[model samples]
Target chain A: MKEHLFEYLLRLGDDSLILGHRVSEWCGHGPILEEDIALTNISLDLIGQATSLLKYAGEVEGKGRDEDQLAFLRLEHDYKNCLLVEQLNGDFGMTIMRQFLFDAYRLPLFEALIHSSDSQLAAIAEKSLKETKYHYRHSAEWVIRLGDGTEESHERIQKAVNSLFKYHVDLFFTNHVDDALLKEGIVPEMKAIHNKWMESVKNVFSEATLEIPSNNWEQSGGRLGRHSEHLGLLLAEMQYMQRAYPNMEW
Target chain B: MSKNDWPLWEVFIRSKQGLNHKHVGSLRAADAEMAIENARDVYTRRSEGISIWVIESNNVYASDPSDMDSLFEPSQTKVYRHPTFYVVPDGISHM
Candidate 1:
């Protein structure tokens, strides 16, 4: 039970940690000053949630490792975020598309997690839900504007959707960890959440006048820790200060 | 990043329920919705406001700076228009 719970917490925490770092990369590089601040603010909210989650995971693991060690010390295979998050933010359109996909999933996931039997997890989900809702709004609005805007924006955003759409399915990757949490009443059913995510995404895409890819190609393995090459590069950049000078603080 | 022609918007924020929406600043956005969202991100990130209002900068008509004397100089000497002559009763503090 402890092992399953610990693994579950790590999956949750790693998702936020990796995605938070990815989003923070947009801090200084958004398309406009307002967008720059908006992206960084979203990144800060995700990182703040990651801090709470990873800290709790460390406690649950009963290991000496704290949130910092868990976040920065984990190898690429040991990290459990979906490939969708680790994917490069190709352009403003691509970043908006990627974030829209993730936010759609996370909003429902957090909403359902609010009813978890585990009080700690439920509390975290409740707090993170507000931030996730705002993130969903931001990304969803941008996705629509980009998809339905001018000719160039429509073309660019369509290309982004085509490229990023493959990763959306893997976000619902479920196996023993989900089964264990499901049996323990610690998580909502993955299928239900997946359906909710699909409905929401479809509604938004239809409104945005974006087409869904007909091919149902599925990509998985991020949950099991197998990841694309991007995660390694991201980790190298993120962990440099920690690895170069172990235990250093400012 | 290259689209510099996005229209400019003026942002107004109501810090609390009872207050009027005061002009905070300006930002550029593609539309009114985006303007409000951008204003929320830029101005209200630190718990600064409970409501927001945004309008395109072009919609606002302002008095010319050259008209300052004609528009305001006559009112400056009209000190009797001030309502400060009467002291409120002790309990009437908000007046």
Candidate 2:
């Protein structure tokens, strides 16, 4: 049970940590100043969430691994994030699309997790849900604006939507670890969360005039640590400082 | 490159429930919603406010600096309008 819980926590923690890292890459690169600050603020919130989750995971594992160690010392294959989060940020349209999809999934997941039998998970979810609500609003608004804006914006974001739709399925990926936790009432039912996610996606996409792809193919495996080529490059940069200067403290 | 220049807005924040919204700073945004959202990101990252209000910079009307005396010189001499003569009871606080 502890092992399964630890793995589940890693799945949650790694997703936030990696996506936070990805969003932080937009620190100085936002198309507008206000959006730059907004994206960076969201990145900070996600990293803050990652800190709490990874710290709790470390405690559950009973390994002296602190949040820093869990975050900085892990190899690419050890990460248990969804494949959607680890994908490269192609453009503003692509980035916003990625964020919108993830926020749709995460908001409901956190909302359901707030009722978990695990008190620690419930507490973290309660705190994270507030931030996720704001993130969802921001990303959803951007999606609607960009998707329905000028002809160029509409075209670019539509292309992004079609390209990124396949990764959405992996968010609800389940395995034996999840099954055990689900039976124990430690995690929410993925099917219910998926339904809520679909409703939200449909509502927002309808507003944005963006079409969901008819194809249902899904590219997954990040949760099982089978990541794409991108994760290696992301980890190389993320782990560079820690790898080069072992035990160095700021 | 300069095609996307959004309108400027002034941000006002009320730090607590009873406090009045005070102007904090200005930022550029495409609309009122974006202005408020930008204000939230730019001004309230430190948890500095409980509420935010944003107004377009162009919508605000300010008195002319050149007409300072014409607009305000008469008020300086109005000692009767001052509240210094009123004495508060001991129990009354924050008046």
Candidate 3:
């Protein structure tokens, strides 16, 4: 049970770590300067969440491995981040779509996990829930504006939506870690989580004048340490400093 | 420039809804919707505003720098326009 809990926390931590890094790439390259700052703010929030989750995972593992160690030292096969997060930032529309989909899943997941039997997990979830609520709102608003805006924007954003929809299904899929956490009351009901996620996504999509894809096939493997092509390159950049200068710290 | 490169917008933020909007910064966006998004991103990241307004920088009218003296110097001598001319009643506690 302890091992499973640790794995669950690591999955959460890795997802945040990967997505944070991906979004941080847009810090200075946003379409507008204000959006640059906003994306960076969201990235910082995700990184903060990763720190908390990884720190808790370390405590559970009792191996003295800190968040930095977990984040920088992990191999490609060892990472448990969802494939959705490691995806390339093709364009502004793609970025917004990526964020909206993940935020949709995370906001409700955090809301439910706040009541976990594990107080550390609950505390982390409680704090992240506030940030995720804002993240979700921000992304949802952008999705609507882009989808319903000018012809060029509508077409581009809709294309981004269609391409990214395939990855959204992996967010709610329960695995062995989930099974163990459920048994211990360390996590909430997955079916209920899925339902809430669907409702939220549907509400946003409807308002955005976007269509929800009918395809049921979803990509996976992040839970089992598999990832899309993008993860390795992102990890190379993120882990470079720590990997090159082992034991160096300020 | 392509339509994607919208005009520059000046962002004004009110710390609270009832407060006056103050010029905070500028951002380039393709439209009013994007301008508002950019303004929210740039100026309000630190919870600095309760509301935001974005107007195209080109659309705003500004007083010419050469007109500064003529536009303002005469007002200083208009003491009758000042509220200080009114004597407050001694019993007006709140005032």
Candidate 4:
């Protein structure tokens, strides 16, 4: 049970940490200065969540490992972030689509987790829910605007949606860690979370006049430390400082 | 580049409930709502404000530079317009 919990938290933490790194790459290169700031703000918030989750995972593992060690020292096979998050941030449209999809899942997942039997998990959920709400809204709004605005925007955002749809299945995979959490009442059923996520996405897409792709070949493997090709470069950049200067602190 | 570019907006913030909104800085955004959000990210990451306002930079009309002396300097000597002439009751605790 403890091992499963540790793995579960590591999965969540890696998702945040990797996505935060991807988003942070937009810090100075966003489509606009305001979006640059917004993306960075979201990045910082996700990284903060990652730190807390990773720290808690370390405590649960009864290891001397801390957030920095978990984040910087973890090899490719050790990370459990989803391939959706680790995918390249190809463009503004792609970034928004990915954010909207993940935030859709995360908002409801966090909302349900607020009632977990684990007190610390509940507390983390409570803190994260507020930030996740804003992130969901922000990305959902962009999806609408880009999908419905100009012809060029519509085409690009539609392409993004089509390209990313295949990764949706991995989000709801109920494995051993999920089963244990379910039995312990620590994690809500993924089916419920998936239904809510789908409804939310559908409503937003309908309003945006965007079509939901029918692709069903969902990708998985992040939970088992498998990832797309982009994560190594991302890790190289993110871990540079900590790797170069061990135990460095600001 | 043209498709990627969004309009620029000036950000204003009210630090607390009763405070008036004041201009803090500028950012680029696609629209007013995003401008407000960007303003929050740029200006209030450290709890700097309780409220935000974002306006297109072009929408704002400023006092002419030539009128700066007449418009602002005349107020400096108007300190007599200040309420120092009146004395408050000693028991006026809130004042």
Candidate 5:
């Protein structure tokens, strides 16, 4: 039970950590100065959430590992995040689409997790839910603006939606670990969350004048330890400082 | 890409619940909603405010610098309008 719980916690923690890293890539590179600052602020919120979650996961594992160790020392394949987060930040439109999809899923996931049988998980979810609400609004508003904006923005964002939509399924993937947690009431049912997520995506896409891709195929496996090539490159950059100087502290 | 510049907005922040909103700075945004969100990210990252108000910069009316003396010179001579004539009691430190 503890092991399954640990894996589940890692899945949650890694999602925030990796997505935080991806969003931080836009720190100085956003399309505009205001957006640059906004994306960076969102990145800070995600990394902060990751720190809290990974720290708690360490406590549950009863290992000597701490947040920094867990974050920086893990192998590329050791991460348990959904593949959606690891997707590259292609362009401003693509980045917004990626963030919107993740935020839509995360908002409800956190809302449900706030009632977890595990008190610590519930507390973390409560704190994170407030931040996720704002994130969802910001990203969703951008999606609407760009998708319904000029011809070029509409075309570019539509392409982004089609390319990124396939990764959304990975977020709700369930296996033995999720089954155990569900049986014990540590988490909510994925089916309900999935339905809610689909409704959100459909409503927003309708407003944005975008269409969901007809293809039902999905690319997954990050939760099972198989990742795309992007994760390797991302880790190399993220872990550089810690890897160079073991146990170094500012 | 749209060639037009995004509109500029002036940001005002209320540092605490009871405090008045004070002008902080300005930034460019596509609309009022984006302006508020941008103000939040740019100004309130340090937990500096409890509320934010953003107004389009173009909507603000400012007095010209050339009219500074004409606009303010009358107030300088109106000492009666000042409350300096009153003396506070020793027990009332704030007054």
Candidate 6:
């Protein structure tokens, strides 16, 4: 039970950590000054959520490791984030599309998790849900703006939707770890969250004049520790300071 | 500076429950909703506000700098407005 819970915590933590890092790349590069600040704020919020979850996971594992160690020292294959999050940020439209999809999924997931039988998980969900609400709104609004804005914006955003949808199913990937946690009421049902995700996506996309690709293709791997080559590249940059400095602190 | 087509909005934040929404800063957003969200990211990241209001910068009309003295000079001598002669009951701490 502890092992399954710990694995589940890593799943939650890694998603936030990786997506946080991915969005942090936009800190200085957002389309405008206000948007730059907004993206970085979202990044900080995700990283903060990751910190709490990883810290709890460390305690659950009864490891000497702390949140910093779990975050900055983990190997590429050890990360459990879904493939959607680890994908590269191609453009502002692409970034917003990616965030919209994830935020749509995350908001409902956290809302359901707030009722978890696990007291600490419920508490974390309650706190993180507030921040995720804003994130979802921000991204969803951007999706509408970009998708309906201009001929160029429409094309770019549509391309983003088409390309990124291939990884959408990976968001619902679950395994024995999820099974055990579900049995114990420590997590929410993935099926319900998936339905909610689809509904939210349909609403936002229709409003944005965007469409999910008709193809039902899917991809998976992050849950079982296998990851794209991109993870290795991302980890190298993320872990560089810690690897080189050997536990140095600012 | 306006970096993109989005219009600039002036942000006002109420720091606490009973406070007035005070002008903090400005940012560019596509519309009013984005303006409010942008203000949240820019001005309230440190729990600096409980509420926010945003208006387009274009909609605000400001007094000319040359009129500063004319607009304000009369108030300088109006010390009666300060209520310095009032005797207060001691229990009113905020006053």
Q: Enumerate residue pairs that collide in model 5.
A: none
Model 6: lDDT of residue A78: 87
lDDT for each residue of candidate 1 in B1-95, tens digit (9 for 90 to 100): 55567999999999999999999999999999989899999999999999999988899999999999999999999998999788788887668
Q: lDDT per residue, candidate 2, B10-95, as tens digits? A: 99999999999999999988789878888999899999999999988899999999999999999999998989888899999999
After superposition of all CA atoms, the RMSD between model 3 and the true structure is: 3.6
In model 1, the clashing pairs are none
User: Cα deviation of A25 in candidate 1 (Å)?
Assistant: 1.1
DockQ of each: 0.83, 0.66, 0.41, 0.55, 0.65, 0.64
lDDT of 2 by residue, A1-250 (tens): 9999999999999999999999999999998888999999999999999999999999999979999999999888899999999889999999999999999999999999999999999999999999999999999998998988889999999999999999987899999999999999999999999999999999999999999998887899889999989999999999999999998889
TM-score of chain A of each: 0.98, 0.99, 0.97, 0.98, 0.99, 0.98
Misplaced by over 4 Å in model 6 are: B1-4, B68-70, B74-95
TM-score for each candidate, following the candidate numbering: 0.96, 0.94, 0.85, 0.89, 0.96, 0.93
Report the lDDT tens digits of candidate 3 across residue range A1-250. Answer: 8889889998899989999999999988987556778899999999999999999889899999998899899899989888899999999999999998899889889999999999999999999999999899889888888888879888988898788888876787677779888988889988898888889888988888888877766787778888888899998999999999997787
Which segments of candidate 3 are over 4 A away from where they belong? B1-10, B14-21, B28-37, B47-70, B78-95
Q: Residues B1-95, candidate 6, lDDT per residue (tens digit)? A: 45667788999999999889999988888899888988888899889999999999989999999999999999999999998889998888887
Extract clashing residue pairs from model 2.
none
Tell me, per candidate, how large a share of the native contacts it keeps: 1.00, 0.75, 0.56, 0.69, 0.75, 0.81
TM-score of candidate 2 versus the correct structure, residues matched by position: 0.94
TM-score of 1: 0.96
Identify the runs in model 1 with alpha carbons over 4 angstroms from their true place: B1-4, B87-95
What lDDT tens digits, residue by residue, belong to model 6 across residues A15-124? 99999999999988887888899999999999999999999999999978899999999888889999989999999998999999999999999999999999999999
Interface RMSD of each: 1.2, 1.6, 2.9, 1.9, 2.1, 1.8
Write candidate 1's Cα lDDT for A135-246 as tens digits: 9999999989888888999899989888888988789988887898898899999898899989988999988899988888778788889999999999999999999999
Evaluated at residue B41, the lDDT of candidate 3 is 68
Pairwise lDDT winner, candidates 1 and 4: 1
Candidate with the greatest DockQ versus the true structure? 1
Pairs in clash, predicted candidate 6: none
**How large is the interface RMSD of candidate 6?**
1.8
TM-score ranking, best first: 5, 1, 2, 6, 4, 3
lDDT of 5 at A32: 83
